[model samples]
Target: MAPTESQHFGVNMSSLEFARSVFGEEEDIGRSLTRGSIPGDMESVTLDSSTPWRLKDLELPPEPIMPLLIEAYFSRFHWYILLFHEPSFWNKTYKVYCQPTWRRRDLSDVVTVLIVAALGLQSVLQDSTWHGHNTFRIHHINHRQLLLDLVSEVRFHLIDLLANPRIEAVQVCTLLSCFYMFHSSPGLAWSTSGMAVRAAYALALHTKAPASQDRIAAQIRYRCWNHITVGDSFVTMIYGRPASVDAAFADLHELEHTDDLTIPPVLLDLTGFSECGDITSKVTFHQMKFRLYYIIRQALNRFRLLRPSQPNTNDDLVAISQEIKDVEASLAQWCQELPSLYNFEDWSLADRWAQLEYSLQNRPADIQEHAEVILLQAAMIQLLYDGAVILTHRPLLKYQVKPMRFSGSVIDSMQKSLDAVIGAALRISSFPVHKFEKHFVVSIVFHYLFMAGVILCIIPTSQPLTNTAQEAKAGVVRIIHASRAMAQHNRISRQTDKLLTELLKIAVQRETLAALDNTSVTGYHGDEAEPPLLDSEMSTTKDVPLEGPKELLQANTTTIYQPDLHREFSMDLPELLQSYHHTLDTGAARNELSDQSLLPSALLPLDPHSVFVSEQLDDIFGSLQSFYS
Candidate 1:
């Protein structure tokens, strides 16, 4: 028989059968072909040609407003650009915004200006309440309305801007991504960042510079490319998605060069009078950040490749673990090699907080500048380095459960890394709410805090109680408080606040039960040379009740730790640990289970062989639901 069109080098077959054979099954074929494909509705298309927001038809903000917006952008947001761009070029380009005919600027330039102005004004307003600046408040409200209108126009014209890609369009897209991030729209920020990455690649921004290009233009292009690279990696990690650009494909030679460029300092009072080394140090801070992000991206990639869903061999797990260790070592070395100017330890938490408060209350120009410098440097270095530590150690949270003997060093490292995370969170929370509003990177602070809380929860069960265990308990309470404060600015902080509170309760209950168990063992074995029950022996004991809901016990069981009797409740150590895991998996609170409010009074029978697939702590911690809120 002749082969049909759907058949491949085989006998004749029915169309449905052929389709199923070629594309797994009917459903798989449908999904593979239709996944994420745009629908036919014209209104839903972002790139519709008939959209009305043409540059000529757009309404520009008033002339007087432009200078204020420009000033705000330069004062607050320009450092992000100056991190990479030659300062002289930035100043030159910024001059165009001051001109009367700025309306005639390129469409991409207009979009860039509007986006920067929007972010800048929003940042100013977020902090204006702290400074009690009535003038800024009045201007902010009017400019906010203007910003809303401009943002809508930008969205309408974005497709047209990207239709013919240019360097300016790349800049616009990059700044737009930042705008979305600052506005607490990370998904949009991530999507816009992808657009910027693709546009930069299209413009060959990552390619080596051509000899014919002007020196300043080449420098700007290199800086822009580096910015996009770092930004893309950052957004990808924040979203827990794969990176758009690979490190191997990026031309990072310019970033590696140590030669000092005499560019105008973004913070004139801080770096204006410094030597070339100072300028290099400023550039190096960003370069180091980029390198650290690249390391994080690699760690994230390895994690994805070795996730539980995929079939994995012991060899695969070992390789991934080794790779993570390598990244951790590299990160530690990076921290040690940081320049003296970027010393993260120079500013104590108390000192920084005091400086910030004095600057805000007194409004001394020098004090304010000093505060800004401290925050800018501290936020940049501490957040990235501490975040890197968290990312590197995060894989261990899963691997710690494996059958290998628990290593004390692993626990120690976890403690130190968590401390770094908590320290960073404390430093950030000390700043006024408005200071955080300007920096989109502050969004990750919630993740850091949540991860710290998760580690604290695990530490008690994973290792024997010691001084570190005591510290872990104290750390959880501290994080709960910090998260509560941070929740004001970022909504993700609230969800973390709830989660940590719950974890803290579990830790307390577990600790109380463990302490009672120790005391009982001591008194019962008094005058005897017998050692206390091992964890294995404790697991099988029937006398002690678990420190959970009374419903977890049968009707025949008697409660020993009733508060009315003033006795201690006790449980088998291993069973208590198991109950902890069960509660985490099922979200079963002891009070809720006992009161029969959240769960049914009749408990479901447990199947020893049945598996309850709980979500990974890493996934729960990494989710941006709170950030989106």
Candidate 2:
């Protein structure tokens, strides 16, 4: 029989067809472009031909504010080092503005500087303090509006900037991508990053420079290409989409090194001798970071290709499992090979906590730089490592087999993955919330926390809880608190805080109910003479009907409460836990619960009728949509 349209697509085709054919025709597709939606025919989209080149209308910050903004960019957004030769640009821009001919500078360079300045101001205002007598205040609202207006002025000339693509144009697109990410617009970031990648490829930035080119200029091109590649890989991972730059086409040349008592002349001239060594070190560090991300991108691509539309055969499942393990091994080796400067081995929790406290109360210039630069780098390395581990083991959660035949090793791997995620979260929690909030992407942090919550929910049913479980729960709570703190400044963090709260409650309830079941079973069996089997054995036995108190039914209902996304977490726990006992008297209800091994347990097979299983998968995939859309 042919499947109904609704059955196959989960929507009424007639309604879709009517909407697409009728109402869609009445709508102006050009207006959708203005609303930031892509059109079906890219060539048909209209551009405003009459928009003036109003570069003079662009406002420049007062002299003091200009330096502050530039400082903020360098202090906070260090990842963009490769995109621009900061010292040279800073000096050049300062000199230009100091003279009368600043307005005569290339419009593209002016727009690029404005983009960076606006982002820098946003970062500063997001993390600044205003002292009014006895009060300290953060003035983000007004500053954000100012930043938006600046961004709008640049957006007004976006087409003009891209019209004559050059190195500066690529920088503009890359900076714009970073700006979108700062505002939690991953979709825009992905799009803009792709544009930058394409622009870089057009300029052959991914190929080795011609011998005729200046060596310093060639080195700069190398850095820019890798920057684009790294940015593309990051967005691809977040969106679970294909990358813009083809790996085979990329130039994988390592930075040239020479043993000398003195630095290169080009480096000395670009950034004074005092800062040359630091610049070289940062470039090398970024190169290493890019390599790690490259590995992750390869793994993500393989996983996407291996994803099955239907249940896999035994051999396919084994292959997928081995593939994941191999990736994990590669990730382990990457971490092992990291340079000592990027390593986090020597930083103790106590030391980080101390630094964090100092950062929150006082932002001394030196300490603040240390926290933002060194500590942030270490945190990022750990975050990426943990994220890779999660991605590596996440597939096992969906790989289903008979419960009796399920391998304990998979469960063990998941446990370790969760532990690593929680450990990373704890490390991040030690950073100053305001600084961390500005520097880190909230969605990524939320992803890690959500993954941890899912693992926490399942572990109790799959195996006994341990001290590691308690530590993991505490880590979740700590990260939730950090998210809440950030929610004050960032809208995305507010959404993340709400989601984490819900997931934490669900995890707590699952653990609580599992404990209750174990207790009730022990008490019930103690009253009889038969020897009690292990809890793991009993939970896995399909033929054994283990008896428990009637209250277990009530607990099950409360544990798996229907999640209402719009509702707050205000339900009465004890009452909800006790209200469903009346249903236990019905034999059909009891049999249904028994046949399914309880209605909402995560340990059950992936049955369509299982509410918890379906909801869990939906929640995981739904969170993923935030990155792509």
Candidate 3:
């Protein structure tokens, strides 16, 4: 569709001229027109339709093409152009003239041309659908070339124009930032990003700019989105491949106000770019995440390293501590800040941002399963901190250095702090929390902390020498008990009350004689010195032949057997002992039965016959000793 004549005219007029027409001639149109240049007599230039349109020609004052061409022949040129030779003249002249004014007219013409060119390039990248065969590589190369030309043409002039109108600077910077970030060649994009920052700051510092500080702050925020875009680009590039997560991070940090913690959410919309499924873009997304993580990690590492040393150095330790506390506090506050819930599963740019409230505000929580990942990360960090605290407290141990000891109070405080965190994890794992299904990880963390606590409790950091046997034995006993307690607590369950079920089992077994009743029994010869017995009488009778070498079973066919074969009888031990001693001797069968009870129930049951009839007569002696000895 062709633009109407009036639309063309609107595009040609500068913002000052448009403003003049809107307010009528009585307004200060002359002053506005003077600041923005007018083409010198508008006659020396010609519209070069055969070649790519020079951006400067498009930014010229509104005038008839024929008359402007005629007047150009007589105009006196500037000394700067006179000094340059023919080749340089054309290049430098075209360059200087392209950067003219901040008015709408100056931008519209060039912007319109650039937009059309961009659309053409986009068509080529999208041309694969039309062609049925992929022509993306060819088109992609062409597209990059076109973008490079466009950026080169606009870089200088755009910066000059944006120096006073921050909003305009922000808009231009944002567009340029995207171009730079998404370009196949990001090096070119970075150059423009640098220019954009210089322009934004220049505009921001202008005392005469009409907006109040608060209003300008909003504008600055609006502009920051561009820098954020640049940051995203750097990250994506570095992460999708191991290009340089740190370098990409450096790029993000280079932008002014990148850490303001109060920029507009749109600026921080790291996920808003085109789908990065392609090879080129795939690394881009990863790099973006890597960059953000890198930034946060670097900050954290720096704070950690600096924090401890602050106390020993001339630096203000309290201030450094307060800074860290501030960041932590801000993080907690941001989490509670009502998130933008307008979009169901898709969060809006606005929803994604809450002011840094503290220093660690540039983090994102957008990937699938991020909650579990972040939870583990938080726990890992907590663990490292706990270990460090422990290391600093240990005294004269192999792992401990004499100069590395922390104060006793410091160790005590850190232990308390860790205990609280562990307690929170235990509570989280035990009860269901909304939007927190990854409680299993929390359970693991809790278990780790609990075991660590037990170890810490049992191992003395320092102790006085004492009685060798008694002290050593007491320490061993203490560790054994503590280990048992830790093991009992470490059992986690996927099912509700699974822990309680096992606890109930233990309670029941403790109170009932069911376990004792299953013990192996001993054999006795009526008031005679008994010979050994055979286990064939104690094993499952179902697996044993009923008449099984009757001598091998037990001497007496009169002996009675119960469903539980552990309890058995024998009238003749000597004959039974001779035949079965090779298979099931009973020298200490009662003791063996007692030991077998400790084997899990899932294994074989202890035989009562071995304990009752053998030397284990002690088991039954308590109840019927009068009949035995």
TM-score of 1: 0.63
Tens digit of lDDT per residue, candidate 3, span 288-345? Answer: 3333333344333344344334224213323343444444443344334312221111
Candidate closest to the true structure, highest TM-score: 2
lDDT of 2: 0.53
Error of 1 at 124 (Å): 1.7
| Candidate 1 residue-wise lDDT, 92-178, digit = tens | 555654444533224555566666667666656545443424544455546456667767777776886776565767777887787
Which residues of candidate 3, in runs, are more than 4 Å off? 1-53, 56-105, 112-142, 156-166, 181-191, 205-322, 340-403, 407-629
- lDDT of residue 285 for candidate 3: 25
lDDT of 2 by residue, 1-629 (tens): 01111222223244333344456745743544332212332322122232323364655544555566666676656443455556666766455544444332256666777787776766656554522211212322356556787788777767766654567768878888877875747678888888888777656676667788866556667767877877777777656577787866654556543221122333333211232234334554666677777777777767777755344444554566677778878887887777554565534434643554454455445434543465456556666676676566555444443322224454455345445544554555443444455553434555554444444433433322344444445555665676777777776667656765655544444343444344445456555676666665443333324565344444432232111210112122223222223222332222322443332223223222321222233333221123123
Q: Where does candidate 2 have its weakest 10-residue lDDT segment?
A: 561-570
Structural similarity to truth (TM-score) of each candidate: 0.63, 0.65, 0.27
